[model samples]
Target: MRSSTLRRHLGLKHEFQYRQWCKANDFTSMIPKDVKIRKNAAEAAAASQTIIDDHAVPLPRKERVIPYSDELFQQAAIEWLIETDQPISALEHPRFREMIGIAACATNGVKIPNCKATRQSIIALFKKNLYDLWTQFAVSNFCCYMVLSAY
Candidate 1:
């Protein structure tokens, strides 16, 4: 097979491995030096293998594992709870925990905050948002005052 055809096949059949190889080395230099085809052996192998319909075979699902941060997750959860008007106690509910566990797919399951922890997170978030809003308001008012004084 031509070098281009072989590269295309590798890219399609072993995409992840091909990408990793490309990242580690120049792809052009990585191509095999020898390209040979035994017609008899190829024909025998092809005859022995049964052809299957593509529609009959289900494609494998790829799962990407992303690093999890407890602090970020807790902050996001607290914000979502507040936005949805749910009680802090909801974080400790078995059903809610189960749902999070299923969604997170962590080996040990995600650690959800208890009522007290949830309340604390909520308070922290509120204080941060309030400070941000106050700063914006103060800056805008100062700018307005400066413009008025200049006039």
Candidate 2:
């Protein structure tokens, strides 16, 4: 079960027992002495860092300029779907679309390619990869043949 669900169950079903257990167990005392020492050290370091940061001059915020290209985005989305073994229909999912939109930094969200376009893009990418592999194999074989001929 999810942590939230488990917490809710414990709170609703065993509130009394949980309170008794909390009262009985000194949680901090249960921790090893070394761990408690390290925890205190970390807290002290964080406090010093906070003080230093407060005294430091603030830097000017620069505006980030992200170039948006629909074709590139679609290609990337297609590749991501293929790499993750997700169905083409995943593009149409509301949550997925929202995430994509947020990532692309678009207020209304970017338009995702339809299933047909996505399928075509996947096929094209596969053919391109196959061609690239074939070319590499051919080049390697040619190099080997040339070396053999020279010898």
Candidate 3:
């Protein structure tokens, strides 16, 4: 097969695997349809005993172990600041760094950018959604308080 064809195949395989991983982790998204021929060929190759293990189809070479998505960062920020009810100012706290670490762990040990730029980016993202998230946190807390008081 031409190198271009192989590269395309590798991309497809990675896409399929990534979809599977996300689904297995209960992340909701529409999984793209796998290319039927590629799927079948891969299955057949796995089933067949090739003559040499060394020449076997190589595992996909992922450029990054953890695929960084904007949504992931947003979700993590929501989880940290809203779900856990941390103050917006707490973004400067070490707890925020721990939350970022948790996000990295959730992606199966993907390398998280821990530099100044990454911190700035996350801070910006959190700032962008601050008002809405704060409203949500207040409402949730009030509801919980009302429920407890009634009991």
TM-scores of the models, in the given order? 0.33, 0.33, 0.22
Candidate 3, 109-137: lDDT as tens digits:
55557689898998899987997899999
Which lDDT tens digits does candidate 1 get at residues 43-66?
889999887776577769655554
RMSD of each candidate relative to the true structure: 21.4, 25.5, 25.7
The sequence of per-residue lDDT tens digits that candidate 2 reaches over residues 59-117 is 79655654668898788889999999999999999999888667666654456689999
Leading candidate by lDDT: 1
Models sorted by TM-score, best on top = 2, 1, 3
Prediction 1 global C-alpha lDDT: 0.77
| lDDT preference between candidates 1 and 2, better one | 1
Regions more than 4 Å wrong, model 2 = 1-102
Worst 10 residues of 3 by lDDT: 28-37
Error of 1 at 8 (Å): 99
Error of 1 at 125 (Å): 0.6
| Model 3 pairs whose backbones collide | none
Each candidate's clash count:
0, 0, 0
